[model samples]
Target: MRVSFLLFAGLLLAAVVSGCGGGSAASSEAASSGNTASGFTSSAAIAVTDPVTVGTLKGMSDALVVGDHIVVRSRSDAFVTLNGQPVYPGTRLSVLDKQGKLVSTTDYGFTLAAGYTGDWVMMLSPDGFIMVQSTSGTRLQHFDAQARLVGGVTDLYPTVAATSTTEYAAAENGGAVDGNGFWLATTFSLLPVTDKTQYVLKLCKFDFSGRQLTPPFMISTSALHPRVAAAGGAVLAGWLEGGGGMLAMWSKGAGAPTIRSINTGGSQPYPLVLTTDGKMGVLWNGKATMTSTGGVMGVMIDNYGTPLLATGRTDLTQETLSAHWDGNVRATVIDAHAYKGGIAIAGSAVGALKAGEPITDVLVLADYTLGTDPLSSSAQTILRFTLPGRAALGPTPVLRQMLFDDHAVLLIGDDNRLQAVYTTRNR
Candidate 1:
């Protein structure tokens, strides 16, 4: 794991040095809006609010909501306390609507934060720990959303595996439900110390009513950094499993997961993403021997983790990458040489049936490829019209949070600002 982290850091440094400089604020804002002839549309106006400037250094950890508001977690150095005593560095969470107006703000008063945006409810916790706060701390603490903190310390750290340390909270239904709409899915690790290292992957479901729908259920493999996507009543989770050697998916209402190992010849699973409609994709360096052999691979999956379509290597070497899905179609953006040179690929599901055989979906890759003439790409020129305010993008950008709602596609970049691309025609 340590080696993997070091390798990732080195790759990131190399990308930054070779890629173009960070994009300017103006260029990041000038991207186009509305549907294109190619079937791509502008972000839904409902999800976009006027941009709010929180601080000079906008950490990637800040939270933003597309539809009603955008929340910027103010940088710690610029902390201003309501009463007295310094608020923890990452303790401030701001709120704003689509019009960029300030809706509300809260002082978490602690450090180490985690959060997920839903339709109406935003779940937040500090240091992988969600608990009730006492009134002895400060007056500002009393004003925040106060939900009854349940369970004991043992219930919190149910597992002791090293890989189980970092837990991410995701909304099962875009956090948009009132009665039975959405629930919070908390994915974490339970590591048991022994002669051999092992981990237990667990997912705890909590309804909007703040009650535990079910206790944490363990998945068989050691999957890390799992992501969940929900559509209708179905929930899909994709994660790096089996010591980061395999990509796995499990559906809440769809039964057991069907795991697939990427034949990368000893390369880590890398990052995996699934579209709102349940399409699955993964990106990784092809082999440990070569630097230029890195590429992205994608597959379309049914509710039962069955692959409906598959896309072979889309070669990318020493480049920063990101991907998102527009329904069953997958779209990827690659910035090589520091955001100077870039390529965009859009893939659709194509399939045919064989005599006496069931139909299998095939992924047909189409080049919407955009880059500088020949070579020497310019960051400003590549994504200027797509992601405004995002500059010197990284490979992780390809897997940044892309939320698909009924009306539009929400492109949340590493910068924490969001771009909404609508799908339906305006009435």
Candidate 2:
């Protein structure tokens, strides 16, 4: 059975703030105003809108907020015969306007049969082009802003090793190449080092049309999960290896990446993000120790790869913030994005009442400024949404965290419908 439709829903909450800086008076005032219907308050200058429906889907999917559109890739559970073949579920691309209204939908002409699993990465170029690269036979697929599958590139690399890990991609200007200013920082595992124990990690550049603009630059033979980001013409990638975080800065015409390794400790680094001020920010989970609480920790570096914080890294989760939770909490960094002169993070926090008690989880939103003293401002829980408990027998719903139009939005899917809550900086 084939099902396609668009629907609208009511707004649950709308809280507006008036200033910047975490744990500031502005945040306190907004929280005290009791302007929320969902029990979530604003910490920074942000305004949250009502929930809207994007589309319906069954199985796995992905969603991203592009300039003025929300691009979604959805697949169903039912099968349909196409060209004398039963396709379990081919991937479909859907585009929705800012108002959560469906704009367009198209099939990628690619499908993954049952029990097939591989890594997939979707990136939006600065020029509104959508690029989806996967190790699941879909090497690289490109789509225009209207959600049309234009073209794709042939697979040139070997299959990823089963034991090797992968990471997200970042896109930036190509610096006057082929009338396509967009390029992506991507990684590939050419061969296994020791029978799937490790792999030779190589970073390369690919234009929007899937053209390999530069040769694959080898980074490490043991690095896993390369996270890439670009801003102000600076391309950066990082991964985990040697019990530390490996960071590298690459130029469009450089021989190799100018690399550096930082002590990420027990926590793994999240995806690399491009700050609004043309700098790169790396956020990671703070490993819980006997001396400190486990929360979110981050570092910001300039284009030259210099740490802007005096401590090299700052722990954003603490009790001093105006919008803070009680007791020690373990944070799961679900998503992070650069928006409105800073970076916003959305995730879940699991906290217990005491050392030996039950734990509850709450949706967390944190906001930080991209200023000279970025670390001086703490990461307060700007907004808190309660995550509804789920039943035991069912697939986990898809949760997407997005930062667009000065708002932080979260999309949750269940029972074939996708509902979204949009939050933005009102000022």
Candidate 3:
């Protein structure tokens, strides 16, 4: 566990952007006649956590909806709340389900720091919230849609012999839930190999009831950061190795992952959008040649990690702020949520390149087709909304992908409140 919460604590986007699923019939009616912001409703920001109080934060990823309004968020310490009040006995794993109707918990076995960022993580499951908690060991707890304790918590560290002591940004992991179950892409430290810092990159799978079902798809690589998303029965991942980018994959029942090094040719491409399927995309930074500027580069791969469209440039404008490549600014806050046939990106852009220069604080929204060029000026819709007054944009904004009735919805958090605004082309 990396104890750098002071650095990473502020990077949370607050909400995951999955197209929201079926909800309670009453709240569904309330949402129909609800207040509209950029086309979605704006809910009042409630007092969810005591930020000033120092305690361990349970879940650091976005608060994903379990059934209806059952938002499963992480607390720094072992605790759960209802209506801003501690409702569970002692400090335990907590949940809220049934369109904000209930809050319950099952006993959690991890004793962790109160101020740690995201040792405990949550994702929506068929029954309810599935929490992956890391302490000296790993525990998986299951809850029902009504926020009731489904089964007992399963400690996987002993079952799988996989350590959970690795730096993992649950958001960047691209861990997804499909029809079969959920998949998480993360790294665990192995014994020092030849006195070198070596890691075991793994994609682990669990059944709907929080049981480790099969052997994980793993590879021994030097890449420190890897992102993963499940596409039906398979998983796709992208990571950096030896100053280059590579994409690897694993079938559900496969023994090991099939890895491939992406050949960028003469183009200097920066890693970017990786879809639920294995189709990888990159934004050319125009660093290699002055004439090429910026364009979209991608390679569409098949189910077995074979290339359908080998890496090539697509017809899109190359204006994703090349400063991210030149090291003018290091910290960036951004999130993208895939829904229906398209994806919605919303966040604050990087600060000005030169200090003391006038900066424009605005919220940016980009909508695009799955394989289409979103940076293209004419092909996709890009909107930049200047914030009220000369407010600043520092940490990434909290944006969630959801659906309000039939509209493709994007919920952006402004002034600490998440507004269900920013509709996309497809529903």
Best-matching candidate per TM-score: 2
What range of 10 consecutive residues in model 2 has the weakest lDDT sum?
A: 1-10
For 56-75, candidate 2 gives per-residue lDDT tens digits of 54343667777776877666
* Per-prediction TM-score to the true structure, in the order listed: 0.45, 0.68, 0.57
lDDT of 3 by residue, 177-280 (tens): 65667766555554322346555566677777656666666654465555555654566676656666566766656766778766443333333334554344
lDDT against true structure, model 3: 0.41
Ranking by TM-score: 2, 3, 1
Candidate 2 Cα lDDT to native: 0.50
Write down the lDDT that model 1 would get.
0.30
Which structure is stronger by lDDT: 1 or 3? 3
lDDT of 1 by residue, 270-389 (tens): 222233333333343332111221233323345455433213423223222212111121223321111101222222211121123222321221112222211111111111112232
Off by over 4 Å in 3: 1-60, 70-117, 134-137, 146-150, 159-174, 191-196, 251-256, 263-334, 351-358, 371-378, 394-397, 408-427
TM-score of 1: 0.45
lDDT of 2 at 410: 65
Task: Report the Cα lDDT for residue 285, model 1.
Answer: 33
User: CA shift at 387, candidate 3, in angstroms?
Assistant: 3.2
